[model samples]
Target: MPTDIAFLAIAEAQQLYHWLPAALELARRPGVRVSVLSPSDQLLALVASYDPQGILRPVRLRRPPSRPDSLFRQPSRLATLLLNYATIARFPTLVTTEISSAWLRRVPGFTSHLILIKHGAGDREGGYKKRHADFDLTLVAGEKDRRRMIDRGLCTPEAIAVGGYAKFELKAPRQRYFYNDDPVLLYNPHFDPALSSWVNHGPAILASLESLTGWNVIIAPHTKLARAAAPIVSHAPHIRVDMGSRHSIDMSYTMSADVYLGDVSSQVYEFLLHPRPCIFLNLDHRDGAGDAFAHWRLGQVIDSADALPQALARATGLQPGFVAAQEAAMQESINLSLVPASQRQADLILNFAQTSHPAKS
Candidate 1:
């Protein structure tokens, strides 16, 4: 059956890394039309590189009068933006990596179905919130999310389904950067001002790396951090600061690093894909208890800069002692599959087409 499905990317960077692979997969399916719509030109350009034949139709809308510059700038008002976009788009089914766009189902004039293709496999509390579970259909990566959402009473099994990690299947093998066989650390920090260590312990850690010559560091903070007006600076000869580069979205940093030093971002799951040493910064002063802090069990948690060096040594040591913990965390955090995830996602979308439930007038 011929079907029309649209993949919407509100942000170009992180989402393109997740959605482009699925778009390419769905494009190859017989009698399926896949369209990619994004407000970010950089994201669109990146999508274009993978779509030279124009299989993914591009959709752009004129700014509604007095509309906020971007949905992210004023996220609380996305309903207005989506309402405006509804005038431009009428796809019976719209797929997105953002939960914020679930409002697409609530647009008054249109009765479109929304399927959320979750962006990453992170254990962040917000990612598992009830709001994140709001969608006509939600494609989860593993059993962890499906169970978590059901346990929270957020969404029923009927609405949520497992589709594996689509990005990993599309991921090419990484070419790691090695400097004289030095043990490299990937310092990945979340961009949340209050929850992230970047604004607090990050500069100290970077300065510490500059003074120390023993270890090579990749200061690859969340891409959003680099979007600041200035480039994040790290003058250390052994350190490289990567802020949302095309390479940042790839698995290079995670695979190349021997130890993962991060706070609150789900990329640690990516680093832990092979069960390596990890150190998490607990700037929020959580006691490291309960389901929310399950990831803290995966690595040594440091609260202050005074403990960073010792933590790093233990973190990079041959027997970091956290190996068992790292393994346990990965099992709880990700659902790895032998099946190509993109193919699984395409299958779901195709099945969804046959049984889609668009809102009725």
Candidate 2:
């Protein structure tokens, strides 16, 4: 029996590193109870270990949709409405990311208010707006993103607040880079072809760097790369493919890197937090394209693999300024002052619970 409000979180194993702590903290609030629906077993195991006290209730989601790319995709409108009805039966308030918010709104008690928590670039697309339109309040990682959201068309324009980088604000620093060591480069490629991929001659760019032993490279491809079951990357003596390392949940590698190499990924924002040199592959150079948010202004965007050599040369040459620019952009994009954005998010959940006035069990 729920005495106050039931908060729901839709999570996965690879995402537990960020969501679990936030879930646990949210559960600690006096009038709030936190429950989770995880799509993977690994996430279940992690929640058990992380919150042995059983503060978090766990639920199983329906079988994942058939399409490989659809795992995180929003469900059909009908499906979303049904899920919302089911949640409404058990909880007074619902708190979730953009994907799950629409469905949860079908729950009767959540009619007057909803809260949307934007996780990454994925949320910035259609996924967030679909559900967030119902939100009485919304949380964003920073001011830049809040403007971006407003431009995208979310409801109640005044409802949005800079939540800071919620994911980073929740975790302990994995490790920090020490100076004078051989710099480590984290090459994180997005899974979208429209953005960056081997189709854009990624191998050629890698081949160009074979002679340079100045840095160790960790190739943390998007998780989808691992789903292929085939070799996502051919071995390189200098390049290590971290197929097993879960960036969806853990970002220590991104946190520690002295340099970042990628196209456009939200991880770039995290990398920018520490201020580092970064290189981008401008496969299509969509900087001025109608979709401006798709363009990441963080680093040098090279159009061809042949140009990588010069980009690397420039990155190493102007390391200080490069790091500063990344850091400055990060500050511009997010509100670092909102330490523990997740906690602030939890407080919003509590406020929703109070407003809803759930009936006694």
Judging by lDDT against the true structure, name the best candidate: 1
Q: Candidate 2 on 1-361: residue-level lDDT in tens?
A: 4434443334433444434555677777664667775444444555677677888877654534533323323234344335445544455455555355455445455443455566663322433445566666677766766776687786456677766666775444556343436667777776665655454666576676565567666777666544443445646566666654444346777776777887756777777666777787776655534333443455777777677667777886666755656666676676777357667666655665575443322
Residue 246 in candidate 2, Cα distance off native in Å: 2.8
Tell me model 1's lDDT, rounded to 2 decimals: 0.72
Q: What's model 2's TM-score?
A: 0.79
Poorest 10 consecutive residues by lDDT, candidate 1: 68-77
lDDT of 2: 0.59
Tens-digit lDDT string for candidate 1 (177-271): 65577788888888767677777666676666676557788888777666542567876678888766667877778877888888888888888
The CA lDDT of each predicted structure is 0.72, 0.59
Q: When superposed on Cα atoms, how far off is each prediction in RMSD? A: 3.3, 4.8
Residue 305 in candidate 2, Cα distance off native in Å: 1.3
lDDT of 2 at 132: 62
